[model samples]
Target: MRPGELVPIRDDAAPRVVERIALVRAAGAVPLVGDPRWSASHWQQVQDAASRAEPDPQIAWAAVTSGSSGRPRIVLRTAASWSSSFPVIADLLEAGPDDAVALPAPAVSSLTQFSLAHAAEGGPRPLLPRGRALVAQDFAEATVLHGTPQALRALLDAEGSPRLRAALVGGSHLDPALRARAEAAGIRVVAYYGAAELSYVAADHGSGLALLPGVEADVRDGELWVRSAYVAARYLDGPLRRDGEWIASGDRATLRDGRVHLLGRMDDAILSASATIVPEEVEAQLRTLPGVRDAAVVGLPHRTLGALVAAVIEPDPDAAPSLDDLRGAAAAVLAPAHRPRRWFMGPLPRTASGKPARAQIVREIQTGEWVRLV
Candidate 1:
């Protein structure tokens, strides 16, 4: 098959998706699974990337990276890279042949595709909801749930949580308060850390994420490096930093008590005149403030400092927290330099996978598209 030739998948059915994946692998054709929500330009970019990709007979599939921090690209992976972890993940979720796995996400998302591939192993055909809004009836027979933290939170808020063996949550940082709520409702929330290139790096039940079995992880110069059978083969457009078997994760983390505590993305660090601040850390504290539903922190260009910390918050509908109130609350937990210098109140822009679109938000803020609250 030609490199630029595309096999677009729009069907969300589990069996159909599974069959198509198998067929593409057999034919050595690149499969592009994109939702209709993607613009025509996005498809064109995928085609362009495919044309530039070096042909690799070992590549079984291609998936678009979630462009939360920057532009999206197509990543190449062999079937074994993902299939090797099915048994481990299934065991973690306690899935059995008779159990029904429910994946409440779009078909294009990597998490949904992974769930579908796992379900194809022997379990009863999985239940795949069209969108994130899942009703109580959707999980009536489901034994396991797999989705992002936002989707799981929506499910809990809508249906008050259903009985499940386990809930595997990923794609973004899992807020401690949200996990507490889910746990209080009798649902086991397993938070995982992974990326498009590296699958199933680490997971945690209550403590920090511990490296999965058969996975090797090391922290070097404040960045995480992973080596495992589940690592992707290569990137179709950009370069993946791989030193032999180790793949640089581009994430900053710390090893504490044999568990991985992720600080944030190395690229998301904010440099001020006096110190460096990690946005994820500040955002976590911001989320705990009164009347704050969600928050995103980014560094804006400044005259004296190279960059200044700024924040965008999704305030609660009933009560919107003022800048002074938020600052007062954050002051207790955050250092003086870490507090947000500029504040905007509104819904944070997110990507298809429900991750905060940091690059796009920064651009909007720089261009005056986002109104400043302070």
Candidate 2:
């Protein structure tokens, strides 16, 4: 580890993640999670960026993009940027000594890595589920689970966390049905909206997504621009760049009554029937429909309309919704352009962090891999 250098720390052991972070910071190198899933070329390109860029001793850790939209790149931020939000997180989660916070692969997720770091500073006891498959027995000792909506659903599918009391959810929309399932299991849920570039933007404790402490938000040109100490300083090799002290997230949102309502990512917007449709608005509507476990709305190539609104559904194992069922339900809520014309039901394509892989789904649909419904 040297000045402006990146040290790849690859480990699944929860306890050691903090030690690795500390060691890298002490040695004047940026701590970067060496996810095995990342290609050698991508890793090398990030390393090259670190080697070329001027080093900042304050920059504590680095995380790569989730690749939900495009190529992954390094996001640099200070250790204090995350630690500053620990109290807010602690207040939000209330992880007691008796509570064990369960999360998956730390080597791939900065969220998990940050959770482990938080644990190191006396948050909650971080626990790795017993085996590869997150079964009920794996979370037998756990009281709280930290993950995205997709990860939570996977845990629920694996016979559920019987003893779990709370879930800290993020990364995507939390469907009403999913929330109801957790509530039925006696597990309380708290969700927050954020990006790797902008740390903790707004959190939904109970009501809606209110801006987190030390964050100032503004909706500019339909995108949320955040000014916060928690924002990452730079991107190693990506299109997104910070403007001064503020970083603009690609999320299309509206800040009203001091709460943020996310529409969708600008990349996920569908241009259909001469209208721009935000996929999240459609996906959120679809998730409320019966028999849908989760959903991803994407824009597929269309001959006349330029792009047609399409949907890929992750159906519940017990029951799957038909094309007509979804369409009929969507008619009441979504505008014609926002309504998905092509429908496909199956397991959704997700990134390493469990966010919908919209670009991947579009490609799958284009290649005739995901069969469209009438």
Candidate 3:
């Protein structure tokens, strides 16, 4: 498809999804997919951006980011970029022609759209349910399930877990306890680390996530750099920092024994009292503490320290651990400055893709929307 030709898919119906896929793959047209819940002005902005997008003959599909951090941008991907991973992923899932793939998320999400395209390639077509609420009976004939960690948890919470051949969980970090519980229910959990610009970087079946086949990964300084055939060409409004074939992923990681252990995003570091703190590292320790159901950590403005570490936690129903208890639990794992000075207890706000909305949570805490528990 030529540049400046964009097809916006605003509908989530099955027919519309099928038609859009055909246009992109069969007819060689670039299809732009965005969240249907977006406001009219947002759609207008997308249209304007699409019109101004430069032509790339290799571009096959375009998708908007979830905008959890800020305004979303359009990313362009080629057919070969994604298609190369479909066979490998399908092999991992043991998907066959008669086996159905259940996609609970809307087609607007890049993750869901990729699953749909993967299914269309020689596997059974994916089942797009109306809402995120999925039941075991909904995918009785399906063998593979794909969605965010939060969505999968909700489905399992609502309806007892279904025995599936494989469940692909991404879009957010998967807690170890959650993965254990899902596996206990007879589902093979396959967790992956990826971005909107990079389709599939690394995946973990049971062990830690290793770089996928045909992908090269390295840690430059602390940021993860990935080079693969699956990376998108470019973003419509922003530039992807590139060093030849390698793209700098903003995520921080450490390579040990040929495996990538994600630390957190480089941009999420908080400079407090001359000490650098990664909120995700603190949050991981917080999740391991007793009575903590979920946690989110963010930096708030401080007079002397520039920024103060703050945390929002959701306590277990029958066990509300106090601030002192939280500190005691994390005392062995985290540094004094890494611990949260201000703490709030409640459910953490999340984006459409189920990632903790860190910016929004910080805003609420600063505006006093969430009462300080500590």
Please, what is the TM-score per model? 0.68, 0.67, 0.70
lDDT tens per residue, model 2, 1-374: 67557777755444475577767766778777764434455455556655676666777778865432123467877778888898888777877656788785444466776776677677788776544455566566778888877667777878556778888887656776788888887888888888777877888867899998889998889988899878876787544556777787877899899999988666666645324466666677678888988999887776435577788889999988778888876665554446777889899889999989988988888888987787
- CA lDDT scores, all candidates in order: 0.74, 0.73, 0.75
Candidate 3 Cα deviation (angstroms), residue 104: 1.2
Model 1 clash pairs?
none
Model 3 per-residue lDDT at 187:
74
- Against the true structure, whose TM-score is highest? 3
Candidate 3 wrong stretches, greater than 4 Å:
1-4, 68-71, 131-137, 160-163, 269-374
Instruction: Name the top lDDT candidate.
Output: 3
RMSD of 1: 12.1
Q: What lDDT tens digits, residue by residue, belong to model 1 across residues 1-374?
A: 65434466754554576578657645766577865444455555555656666567676666776432113467777768888998878777777678776777666667777766666566434676644346667666776788777667777777633656578888766778878988887788898988878988999988889999989999999999999999988787656799999999988999888899887768777756424576777787788889999999998877445578898999999999988898777765565567788999888899999978889999998888999986
Model 2 error, position 174 (Å): 0.9
The best-first sequence of candidates by TM-score reads 3, 1, 2
Query: Which of candidates 1 and 3 is the stronger one according to TM-score?
Result: 3
Query: By summed lDDT, which 10 consecutive residues of candidate 3 come out lowest?
Result: 64-73
